[model samples]
Target: MEIQNDSPVNPKQVTSAQERGNPADVAQSGDFNNSNSKKKKAPDTEGGTAKGTILSIKLAPATDLWTTLKNGSVKLRMEETCCGGVSPLTVTQMFQKTVDLCGDHVAIGFKQEKQWKTLTFAQYYAECRKAAKSFLKLGLERFHGVGILGFNSPEWLIANVGAIMAGGLAVGIYATNSPEACKYVALHCEANILVVENANQLKKILEVQNQLPHLKAIIQYKFALEVRQPNIYMWKAFMKIGEKIPESKLDEIIDSQVANQCCTLIYTSGTTGVPKAVMLSQDNLTWTANTAGKMVDIKPAAREKVVSFLPMSHIAAQMMDIWIPMKFGAATYFAEPDALKGSLVNTLREVRPTAFLGVPRVWEKIEEKMKETSAGSSALKRKIAIWAKDIGLKAGYNNMYGNTHVPCGFALANSLVFKKVRVLLGLDHCTKYFTGAAPITKDTLEFFLSLRIPIFELYGMSESTGPHTVSQKDFFRMTSCGKTMDGCKTKIDKPDELGSGEICFWGRNIFMGYLNMGEQTREAIDKAGWLHSGDLGKFDEDDFLYITGRIKELIITAGGENIAPVPIEDSVKSKLPIISNAMLIGDKRKFLSMLLTLKCYMDDETGAPLDALAPTSVVFCHKNECPATFVSEVLRKHDPAFYKAIQDGIDAVNSKATSNAQKIQKWVILEKDFSIIGGELGPTMKLRRGVVLKMYKDIIESFYVD
Candidate 1:
């Protein structure tokens, strides 16, 4: 009732302010505790000693008390009409509900020794509790961070939920993050315990362990320890460390937790600047999970399945792979670590996930692969594919346009081509296909539409806790991000003639704030509590939201014309199928120019873009009589024929431009494509405009030289 820390730890020492002081001094303070005037009983649990009994725990009501952790309080709208009737349950309580309802359901599956190993909901919950106790034993301070660095695995989920359960922030670090980047997040979050996946991640922490005085322990959840370090524990050893810690102690921390308290920290990808620690509360996760899951048609008690491969550090992946599944009692299968490199499709085929989410690049890759495969077909096969694709596109458009009647020959097309293709891609069971975290091109959407696979587009930022607007089969349109979820409101602030303006969000799912950054928080969430998203958007008459551009990415020409780069870039790529990426380079310049990269093959193992052109690009070159194999060949030769072909494509794109200001005046084909490994794209495949500008500064200036 009187929730106070009985452990030998001080709550005052764990202030959310970036800890730069000595931990020893902070450790010598008073007891870690928080309580209101009124007392409450301990959480009620429902589970007998009998095996297979459904287990559930119900926590006491959240007291009118706030922790002293800096930027740790929730700012959720408590209105019953907001946030889909905003559930007043902590993440633990939410997971417990799933356990009670679907305890015997397969909760997690992982590939090992070429077979799938499964875990039930009850087993998953037990593992999380064990992990929570381990984190506590490892000295995870209250409100402090437990930085999790790894590929998406069952252990990763356990570590994340376990940290929150143990009253600490679960901070997910991108696997691609450099050691310095990892250090920045770890130090910024004041991580007391680092849960790393393997030696590679451990090495990153070890490089800066000395600088992190507050980091008390490092637990490697995978691979054997290569070094005998003092505070470094193996996964098995770490789990056993908390055996002496009583269940009552861990339960007390869980029972004291409120729905509106900071429990998760998602660091921004830092595309433009140092990644800000976006503070997400318990309600942010629980509410968004429940609301968005329902919006996407993930029915409760349904045997929904998803393959987890995208970086869990990102909110999109976190929600799809972790929280949403927990909310609906869905099963999650962990794709191999090399999923992005090429193994994802295999995993998709094996799991046959009911729902699949991919970044724009991921979808584009799939489209390219399909095209490449189609190009290799014999005359007869190619003819049938073309016939089926035509019908598929018609049917897809019919559905999008609300024409309930199926297009003629649609059933035949589905049986002959669409069904076969879906089976090959292991997407036959997929009810929802999603693309987000960046703008997906109309070209990619229609390409999939031609295959009877309409990839739904999701729109949101880390601040919205994952989804604000979601496109589903029921409410979908080409290039439209769809409408907001129930109870979540969107407003267009300072609209222009066409109603395009900075989009703002208001709902319970809105994050608490950026950790330790009051000014930034104020800038993001304004006086009316609306989170002012920097992206520009407008809603249609039907209320479908279409993202126009990002305010920051808008190029102000020297003549004072504001140009959005995305539309121009997408148009140019559509015109030139060989062009993989295009960046409009006319900000503050007299005329618009572009930096283009040829569609090229990428190293299957490393995900590094290769110099050789992709099959589609090769086909383009052959058809155009340009005849180029590698990007280097075209760049080195300055192949007049290829350049002229590209120029012709640009001219075609320019003809559709609304104004000369939006037209591409000149352009250059880069030797390589933009990639995460090349540092031009973030983990979610969102282009890092600032990084690209700096990397190609001289090239950009070349187009403008007098």
Candidate 2:
């Protein structure tokens, strides 16, 4: 299966990679409320008068693959049935019902001043109401998108739900977004009020505030020492303003809300152009929460728990960390933004969460850690680990279709190896572990599965309200992205000779449209109301979806052979642990070539290198950015042995190629990987192929010329 991204992970500057979607890694915040600003007409979306111009960067345009169908097959659709009969529950309504069902239940926990504070479902609902009143007092009106800028915090959730309660649309700005990006989103959405995470985030908006005429007020949740500006308010002060308003008005406002109205605007990770705000209604989120919650079995009786480590701004995080838990009143623990780089694994161990939602990198890191641990063990234990893992791999493959009826020796293998590994990874109780936002290698999935961890790969987009298809436990497929989620409709738009086509969806979960952008909206959602996902995929006879890369990204070689590069790149990285990023370049070329980068696992807590490949881990120190110095550091560790190992890995992957056209015939190791700030990766950690091609033109030419 093929997978890719829009620019999200900003590799160097922000921990969260642009176009990688949201990794929720490193964070750097500063506001831009520029004092002097020109006024300009706001975009078509509802709001105050947005002022100033925005520098919009768009990825290469996408075309519908329906035009490429040879057979002109009717779009085949599938929808699963689940979520016992019930009406839609808006997020606000869900909050109310959850409070009623279990007012005393611990709804959420967040660390503050070195202590974790717990809030009941009732307290959370009340807090949201108080925040809603505060937003109303600030003159925020219906559909006036309110911006919440920060890392994942209790305050972020409060502001988001509060804005919706106050009859405004909440726009979540990625914590890694620049002042310019923050300004563009704030203005484009015409945010009347923006709740900043802390002083740093506030400072980012403040530096560019003059340019946003529509912005009426700024609220800082974590910063309390400073005096408030005329339009700025602190957390305590802001809540107090809400107290002045009678409680009856808040109830009335909540009761008056409808599900059809747009509640949130999730902006697409803009790799090439301006991030289009995908308008999702109350129904979209509610239905998604219900269906997804049911499919994943997140219920009160299930004893569910989650580590909210992903970006709250992302739909995946919103669904898993927020909506799903709200259904059963399960608890969510926020991973402190500052501690995420160092404390995530430790936190997971302590939490021992029942659900672990991660991107591919998180799982890969876990796998790498397990391997390191095994490698350091005694010879006999290492042999046992290897034997058990091999046994599990065979059993895992058999269990891909259904539960395994393994030999009695399997239990011994689990006792000797698998169970202990699961405990060390802090997933002993995890039943709903899944990887999204990026494509996880089949090898990674199989390894975890063999370890007795059921790791399902899901498929969906923000346009489809997070996930539309997920690998199921009852009817699993190793490579397929499960089946169409219950209550969602999925179809393949057109078929090639092999039945590959663009994946499309039509259901309550599909987004309403892109806010005020009719043409783009029409392009995305056709007359039949199908949400056309530019991602290409196919459905097996049993109806599981298999993604096959972006239509725009498909490389047609000089020999006129179409090759999907994701699988080949994934194979290379899977076999070579040292390689961090593998970008294949063969568009219109005679043969496939690649650029590789090494991983840098820094011990963030102690300022030491953690990755074995890092010379700074225990060797010499070199922090300068000179290419020669970087190259030396990379080549220093990648000696003849490393070259042979890399070559061996390449040779193995090339052997799997159906034909020579699809194989990576040549490759060059690079000192650095594509970073978001470098304009080489999307927020989702997807390589900006177009940008990468241009930046490394000389290196690419050298590949063929040499």
On TM-score, the leading prediction is 1
Candidate 2 displacement at residue 377 in angstroms:
1.8
RMSD per model, one decimal: 8.6, 13.1
Report the CA-based lDDT of candidate 1 relative to the real structure.
0.83
How much is 671 displaced in model 1, in angstroms?
1.3
Query: Which candidate tops lDDT?
Result: 1
Q: How big is the positional error of residue 571 in model 1, measured in Å on the Cα after superposition?
A: 0.7
- lDDT of every predicted structure (CA atoms): 0.83, 0.71
Task: Please identify model 1 stretches exceeding 4 Å from their true place.
Answer: 1-71
Regions of model 2 farther than 4 Å from truth: 1-86, 224-228, 338-340, 603-631, 634-641, 674-681, 704-706
Query: Each model's TM-score, in the order given?
Result: 0.91, 0.83
**Residue-wise lDDT of candidate 2 within 83-127, one digit each (tens)?**
312234467766776677678988888887877889999999889
Across 529-557, the per-residue lDDT of candidate 1 in tens digits comes to 66889999988888888999999999999
Q: After superposition, how far is residue 591 of candidate 2 from its true place, in Å?
A: 3.4
